[model samples]
Target chain A: MLLDKFQSMAGVRAELEAIGIVPFGAVTEKITSATEGVVNGHQVILAGTNNYLGMSFDTRCIASAQAAAETWGTGTTGSRMANGTFAEHIALEQELAQFYGVDQAIVFTTGYAATQGMCATLAGPGDVILLDADSHASIYAGAQLSGAEIIRFKHSDTNDLEKRLRRLGDRTGNTLIVVEGIYSMLGDVAPLKEIAELKRRYGGYLLVDEAHSMGVLGEHGRGAAEAAGVEDDVDFIAGTFSKSLGATGGFCVSRHALLEAIRFSVRSYIFTASATPGVIASVRTALKIITAEPQRRERLWENAQLLYTGLKQLGLAVGPSVSPVVAVTIEDRVEALQSWQKLLEAGVYVNLVVPPASPSEKSMLRCSVSAAHSPEQIDHIIAAFAAVNAARPVGIPVA
Target chain B: MPNYNIYVDYIYTVLRTIKQDVEFTENTDLVTELGLSSLQVMELIEHIEDHFDISISLNILPDINTVGDLARKLQELNG
Candidate 1:
């Protein structure tokens, strides 16, 4: 009798799950031999994960994780500030600072925590926090929590940003500019140099979240800020170890020592339990491998360029994406879901981004490529898309 | 930009950003005509807030439906 809200949720859940785009709790590793799933009793290629560098199964990282887990047991069991602080965490922070060529680096339990914590701590009641309209939800939540007058500029529109900044005038005292290094859905990168210059002029702190671009972009795998040659121009560079590094954790690095002040102020860091030793060990190994293995970055770019070129040659709309994450836009949500189901059925898995996730009218198929995928596997994926996309929708296809 | 309806253009951009229909008229309801969910409509408010640099009251937004309605409100706020 009192199940109306739950019933509505159940309906939405049923619709989503029926289409193969299983939400969190319902995710069936239908192909579990490799990453845990039981899909028709056989292992399936996992292409949807944000595993850009494919370092998850690397020998060194695995070995390091094993060692740390064995040595430190299971969990940290406390926050970083109190009983949770470990030598490994400090070492990782130092390594991340050196890696980013920044003077300061503060680690957090998650990339989301890093973004939210830093933004929330830095911005104040009267301050303006302007961000790209397409920024991640974490950034939005952080802005909300910061009590800052949040502003949104058109995605990647420098002139629009200038207009917003101009309006703020001398009130720019505590203005904080935030943008993502690589957008999650579209995979398009931000114009960091243009934005950094704007920040420089406006006299505000600039923060770049490299959650999607951590090891995917930049020659040194530093991120968009480094790639855009604005590493120095940017005031803060926050990143996740989840993507290219193939681990779980986040860090915020900066040229100014003031960013360290946020450690005492940010609640997300002080409240949550610290990251496990295993993640730190593996992330360190992965970061080293990321910097040393230029070949991985090259191969990743090769795979991305191949897929993008191949998709474009097929005469389908593939991106606004300039990175390894390629998105094919579909105007209809049902059509998008159908395409995703077909891809899963064919053993080529990708992320299904509908309505709320997409910052545009079209739902998107977000395919993330990695260095681990061979030329043949890459070709097979493209061929599959070609066949699948061509067969469906005689009048209109998802792409 | 010539002969273009700036109001409709702006509305289309905002609606498309939130994955709603681009169709709108003077009497169309912002929530009903476009079928905007509560979340998306809030996002629309955020878009308007940034574009205009003026915070809108919750009550004033509920009566808005079409691009004309929103544009007129924006003009009033600016004035």
Candidate 2:
């Protein structure tokens, strides 16, 4: 009886399978290269992963991770506040802080934990959180955990944000406004300049989640805040090592002298074990590569443009902006699945996204580009999409 | 910007921008009739906020069903 709520999920699963869209449990047989993988007996080009810099296969990163695994062993048995605080963990935190030119930084087990813990720890009860309507799920979870008075403003509408802030009157100072550097779904950049200006006028703290922006924006790869020339204006920045850094971890950096105070209050951080030594070591190496080789970022954008313009030329609808994330949208779920399966058959692999996960219930065949992808690989991806679009099932139109 | 008629015309224009094939009327349901996604509906709300200089709560989205409902809300906020 306690598990009866799962029936609704079962009904939804049945409906999706009947429509030929299975949105879960995809297993890749082997990763032969940075850009290609074997899935279901087919060698497919990997375009769905968030490995933006393609450093996952970098020899230096792998070498460092292998060395760390030998040196530090496998897992840390304790959390950061307890026995889990290793020297390398503290060193990585210091390195991230220095990279962002912030006074302090705290690394978490995952990016989701960093965002959720920071938001939950920073503000609570009487405090208000005026967040972008299109914010990621982690941010919303953070606000809920914080017990803050949550209010969502129109996405990217500075004027509306100001109006909501103004309505708070004396409570504005305690407000924490949260926004992302780049939205994960549509790959759109936030108006950090305008939002920063509004925070100035309203006297509220600003939190920018750079999960998808780090190593892809600004001269130093600091993310949208730096790209908008408002890095100094942002109060807190939460980011991840999984995307461009090609490792797995999350961190929050702040210029605030009191940022270390959150370490004691964050339940997620207090309860969870620290990242593995191998991951921390690999991420440190990846950070060095990100700084040393800006060409990877440039090539990433070129590939994005190549795929974006190619899909547009083929008359397929894509996301609003051009970034590493290129989402090809279809009208409904059935069409989305059919196109995705067709792309797989043509030796391409992309993410099949549907409602609840996708904004506005829009179904998307999401492709994430990487510097590791060759020009021919990019062409193959475009050609695969074209083939699927040309042979699309009858009566199902592109939205 | 000057009157309710202008607001109505402006809202109609924004609706058309979301979907070119749709015909706008007071009775047109935003979801079923216009086929606007939740994200597109948010876009519509943003355009409305920009034009009227008002902040509409996201919670009001479910209460609104048709073009006339949106118009009435806009008028209420304007007053």
Candidate 3:
């Protein structure tokens, strides 16, 4: 009976496979390099990976990760509060705080846990959480666990957010407004400037999850909050190392000195094993490289512009604006699936996203551009889209 | 007394934002006819609750199917 809820999913899977679209988890056979990979025995250009800065293959990062594994064993057998916190972990936290110019930084095993822990630890039952309707699953999960009254405003509609805040009346001061810097699915940056202004007027804590925008925005690559000159207004920032940092971990940094108290209170942080030595070392090295090599960010933007312009020229529908991620939106699921399969067959790979998970219930082929993508590869990806568009014209009406 | 026309107009306004050039009748199905997903419905509810100064429980959600159902329920709750 427990598995009965998921029984209908098998039918959905068969329908997707019937149209040659692989749902959920599709495996890449091998990764030959940072930007190139062999998927399903075919050498495919990776356009869907979130390796924005492309530091995964950097020599310093790789060497540091390898050395860390050798110095310390492969895994931390316990949680950070227990037997897991290493000097590298503490050092990385310190460096992150310095990078963000925040007072405290707490690292989590994964980005999801960081948000989950922050929401659960910070907001309680009587408090409120006003979030964007298109927020990522992790934020929603955290809000659910927070025991707080959850409210959602129209996506990117700051006016609607202000309406909700005004309606909160006396509860406005105790509310937490959650938004993402760059929404993972649509790749649109939040209107942080206006939202920060709202926070000032309404009196509430602002949390921005820069999971996709960190290392891709701002003069110093702080995030959208920094880019919009609202870094001081943002009360907390949660971000992931899996993206631009090219490793796997999450962090929450804040200006509030009391933020360090979360380490002892967050069950997600206290219970889960800390990130391995290798990931910590690699992320630390990547963070240093992010600050040192500003050109990587520039190159990433250039690549993003190239792909975005090319896709648009090919008459494909893309997300709001050009950033590291470019999502080609398709309203119909079957058409999206067919297009995804067609792109893969042409030696190109991108994420095939579907309803409920994707914002606004539309399907999308999400592609994230990397700084390391060569001009030829960018051209190749555009050409692949052109070919697929010419062959299958995704705008075909449903029968 | 609450103005019924105002509540109807408010519901219509929310539906129009989701889709313009569409008309909302009292018996119009929000989901099937208007093509609103569950998330959009929740957004509609939030808009109503905020402007009406009322809290709608999830228990009443199952009873709401059409625009009239929602409007009538809001009136009942307000009373």
Candidate 4:
């Protein structure tokens, strides 16, 4: 059955490769120089990554990781549901809870696991999971596993949302409306306060995932919910340290005591080992930097604005992004592939997205600006996009 | 109870923001008049679920041809 499934999807890998995405995590994984990624021995800029904060190389984080690795050895060797809870793990969870200003926090080995696990635990059968159509695959997977009837809301349209709710009546009691603080693809934000207002009036919980927005948005880096002034109104906050934190783990923090119960019941939580010592240490250090050094976030935004304004000025179809994630939406898939190659040839690397990752028949050349980037680097990024824009009048549609 | 009034209000907001022009009471084809692609229609339904705090099945999604048709469907769900 496994081989049959493989055979059925045999075209997927080759198909993706033909489009330039290639077996991304699989390829280019060979040991290369740290400062630049070598793809076929060509040094390429990594604009596709969600590393908005660039704390992956923070010396203090590295030191903390090394220190934790030396102290705790390697892996936890057990799940948090069992003997996996080390003092460091407990301390990290406590610190994260305090950081988010929530009563309890549970750490998962990956952000994907956290989103799926917490969604599954929080929503149930006969309940509703209203999601954004543009939500990440992790959110969709969580909603699917949660046994709730999945409902999709138009991306950022609060009015279409109210109509869908009126259609549900008393069933609203069991609903969990899911949204993200900053959407990974187009880098757009949800209308959180309005969503929260509906959730409050209609009797449901709001679960906001700040996976991409953590350390990148809001005053204290609390994310889009804080930006919208709906922090306390959100029932659960889910995020991962992978993107901005440059670590590998996920977390769910909530004011509900019920969240603590999910720790015992969720299989994904029960069976999986907790985050490694190094990861926890790095995240702890990363969180401190995210809060203490607001300059990183500011610089990241400045870079984003530079790139965005530059591309627009030079006549490119850049997205209406409010964050560091700027998307260049193209209409045709093959054309997107060609544009990706062009940008690469121009010395910048970006994410090449096609449907169903892209919405509304849209393909995107996704570029993420980072705090690690220099202004010259930002200008180079702009120049690269400008070159691509000038060279091609592609078949991208205006919606 | 002005349930139709609520439907018109919702439609007004959607049209103003997403579409731009539409008559409330006449035959208003959801896809054509609202200019909603299939993907956007799906998103619209999801937004309705969140807005009303209720669950709607993708299966029950109506071929919304007129403003009255959408209003009637909303009444059925609200019932």
- The prediction achieving the highest lDDT against the true structure is 3
Give the winner by lDDT: 2 or 3: 3
lDDT by residue (tens digit), candidate 3, A140-197: 8888888887877879999888888887888988899999999998789999999999
lDDT of 4 by residue, A1-399 (tens): 657758635677778776555524423433222223654334666777788888777889999999999999888899887888888888888999999888799888999999988887777788888887678888887777777787877677788677667766787888888889888888888889899998878777888999988888799998999888989899999999998898899999998888888788776788899899998998998888888999988988988888888876766677775568888888777677777877777767788887766876778888888888888877888888777666765433433
Deviation (Å) of A345 in candidate 2: 1.5
TM-scores of all predicted structures: 0.86, 0.85, 0.90, 0.82
Chain A superposition TM-score, candidate 1: 0.94
| Higher-DockQ candidate of 1 and 4 | 4
Better of 3 and 4 by TM-score: 3
CA deviation > 4 Å runs, candidate 2: A15-21, A393-396, B1-79
TM-score of the second chain, each candidate in turn, equals 0.69, 0.86, 0.89, 0.70
Best by TM-score: 3
Provide the clashing-pair count of each candidate structure. Answer: 11, 0, 0, 18
Estimate how well candidate 3 is docked, as a DockQ score: 0.20
- By DockQ, the best candidate is 4
Rank all candidate structures by their lDDT, best first, as comma-separated numbers: 3, 2, 1, 4
The DockQ values of the predictions, listed in order, are 0.14, 0.19, 0.20, 0.28
TM-score of 4: 0.82
What candidate 4 gets wrong by more than 4 Å, as runs, is A1-9, A12-26, A29-35, A393-399, B1-55, B58-79
